[model samples]
Target: MMNRNFNRRKKFIFFLPVAVLIVAVLGYVVMFLWNWILPEVAHAGKLNYWQALGLLVLCRLLFGNFNKGGGHNGFRERARGMRAKWDSMNEEERAKFKEEYKRRCGGWGHHRNKE
Candidate 1:
């Protein structure tokens, strides 16, 4: 079992870069294909570069994780708010949380319980 695990790790180490390169190449090919298809299929109303850029931005706005007001953006905003809550806590609350954390965690790096 150990030998098999070692061989699997070695195989992954050797193949991971190759897999990434293949994925990158495939993405470029797909992009080129999309560009080719768009102009050909919509000959009556060809989308210019800015139009394509706008579509890409819109798609990203709708589907991407970083768009504001939702998704990762909202997640990030919530995280920031949480952080602010932590930061804005009065000294008593901060001290209490520290006490609770220390009591639960047995003091960050120390193994022994406070006696």
Candidate 2:
């Protein structure tokens, strides 16, 4: 299995420039799209390369993840834990848990018999 704690610094060294180029291309695309469509449609002003780059950074900061590992925020880890617990549960335990969850969450026609 691949090491989960692989050397991040080494990976960054290999991928940093590629990542930068990708971001630059994305910024250019944003600038092109905005210039192409927005001005005529919404009377928006045009953006220079620097402005586009700034906008890209701003959007990333506002709506995207700037953190390392793309900001998974422990979701993958939590999911793995949940999956493991679910897999370990026996059929009866699983059924009981499911019914309890439905009861707590308000069953949506789950109380009705299936035809």
RMSD of each: 16.4, 8.5
Structural similarity to truth (TM-score) of each candidate: 0.34, 0.49
Compared with the true structure, model 2 gives a TM-score of 0.49
| Lowest summed lDDT window (length 10), candidate 1 | 65-74
Clashes of 1: 0
lDDT of each: 0.70, 0.85
In model 2, which runs have C-alpha deviations exceeding 4 angstroms? 1-25, 40-45, 66-69, 103-115
Give lDDT tens digits, candidate 2, residues 67-109.
7756567888999999999999999999999988766775575
